[model samples]
Target: MHRGTNLPAVGGYNQALILDVIRRSGEGASRVELAEKTGLSAQTLSNVSRRLLDEGLIRESGKMVTGPGKPRTILRLEPEARFAVGVHLDPTVITYVVLDLEGHVVAHSRTRTPVGTKPEETIRRLTVSVNAIIETSGIDATRILGIGIAAPGPLDAEGGQVFNPPLMTEWHNVPLGASLAASTGLPVFVEKDVTAAVAAEQWMGALGDLKNSLFFYYGTGVGAGLVVDGAVVRGASSNSGDIGHLIVDPDGPLCRCGKRGCLGDSVAPVSLVLEAIEAGLVSAPTGELDSVTVDNDFTRLLSLADEGNGHAVVIVERAARRIARGVLAIVSILDVDRVVFGGPFWDRASRAYLGVVPGAVADDPALMMTHPIRFEQSKLGADVAAIGAGCLVLDRVLSPKPTDLLI
Candidate 1:
């Protein structure tokens, strides 16, 4: 779940709607084009455009000549007029991305989370990294709308605290949103990493137009994000997408959550690496493959599979089959028409997973419940969550929703 605030929803709603319409037009939009696309009256468009231009959120780029009339001014979004900071707080590392109004990553930085150190120290480091990017990128600080943090969930999003996230016990009830806001001198919002990634997908990914979809987040851990009726499903506690614990194979492996053959137990990075080692596909020395190296180990194994290692390919296919079962369950439960794969580890694993997962899903009996569901490999790449976090800020301030039109 992502909590957003400081929305200017009065006449700002109409302005946001027009801005979105202009943004979708790419090069620029004339007043007539904006009116047609946004369904606002010519007078309303004129009023809104004036206010937007006065606010510096948009500018007249040039003029388009017509056959029998005067030139029409083309309005374009001022990409530098606003900015947002996105952060992914994974257990192994923290990723930062700075996005402008157009959702481009203007700057990025990565740092290892000081897990062994105090929680406050990690927060302070996060603050420093965020400030550093803003300072170095040469973007005006006043233009930064806010900061969004994507952290592992099972915590309280509305309350802004992380509670007992797996493996990272040190971050318990850390009040991440408030703390980051206090340290950065900006409004902050916190979201589950997968949900944030889904936000990124909805705002800018290839499948952004889909109202119902599933995002399978394959990172250091496996989780999911669901979008139902064009809204990100956050569950009652904002911990909705914990699909990693869904039981996909009852007789296979014992999961840490006391379940037999959970999705996380089957295809999470650590599990994949371990499976590779057990099958002799990874012949690393003992004690070298531990908790700390699971990410690197999985990357190495995925590279092997990519490089035509037969045994490594077998391991990934097996994992893909298990993962497909999980995907089927989520799609059936949600009755969604689309599923997308993403997260940090997706690139390394996509070639194998995409090759196998779709066929497995297509063959499932659940396919009968919906129209032909579309499957896509995420184009958002490894920074999906980080980018989503930034988009959260943009969405809060700019994107027009039905509620915006109510009042």
Candidate 2:
């Protein structure tokens, strides 16, 4: 069962609201600042401050001597007061991260995922990994709030179940959240990996206070995460952001879903590697390039492209162009001003894609009437989804939005 209710305590919502205000005020805020920002009475602010202080959620950091009668005590969040665990499940890898109250990753671990592994095996492996990290971190178990899991979608997030993700065909209808919770004795919150990545950007990224943006997540697969009004946009079934199937090229290769030139089949790592191999860039002495696994082939092609291999560069550029087309279509329809490119693929392909994608979007005629769009690389690197998962835990417990209020 999901241990923490989405609806926070009636007073809990107000307390969380104050804490959020403090967290954003990195320089610390006086009680007056809290009252002014939160629109709560001075008396209410005092009561909340006292409770937060007694609970150790917030602490008086220092005194700000304004133009005035007395030095005002400034308060700030105590990041070490609580923690959340984030797990990112990808077809190629599984990443775990422990995040403090302020969304900084304190500890992390990564392991290669066994493709086609059964759900039970994957669950067991995940449980052990989660236990090991928490045990080694030396943080008191009670202070650990809960676990957030970011898994590849087409998932039933509300139900804590994973459906048939494109790459991981074996994970059909797995009760991931309930099973993990039962195994670890902790609340488990599951989200689509792409949506979770968007949450990370919204919670702590360069795009602060920007209400609308799209995250183009390129991992073992290609997907998009949408944010509107500072909340992740999940379509009615909680499985939106499945941009992989959007047909980018009618004449391109066939996707695994039996469609022609779907986005997933176009720029997915496996698709890129297969393209490289077919183009003669991934050849070997034994003609055994086929023996190389998907990740290895993809990494080799990206490495070659980075080293200025002409063939590899051409392949990357083509992939970037295809990706740009998809991005342009998305930006035009959604009218999102900020577009972020990220995931494990970002680290290696940033140089290649950045060279072409921004120009591609900028040159598009659709932008003549709209404000200039900003294209950025992800600041959180590969940990974006994992951190976002952790943020999901923190957001449920600490964010002060109206949805958390029980009217």
* Full-model lDDT for every candidate: 0.85, 0.85
TM-score, every prediction: 0.89, 0.92
Q: Give the per-residue Cα lDDT of candidate 1 at 244.
A: 77
Lowest lDDT 10-mer window, candidate 1? 1-10
- Predicted candidate 2 versus true structure: per-residue lDDT over 1-407, tens digit per residue: 01122222456777888888888888889998788787777777888889999999999998998896889999999999999999999887899999999999999999888755699899999999999989899889898999999999888888999988867878788999999999999999999999999989888855666577889999988888998766679899878888888887788799778999888889888788878978898753354333237667788898899899998998888888889888988887787888998997778788889999999878867554258778887899999999989999999888766665546
TM-score of candidate 2 relative to the true fold: 0.92
Superposed model 1: Cα runs more than 4 Å off: 1-9, 35-44, 65-68, 283-292, 306-311, 401-407
- In candidate 2, residue 146 scores what lDDT? 97
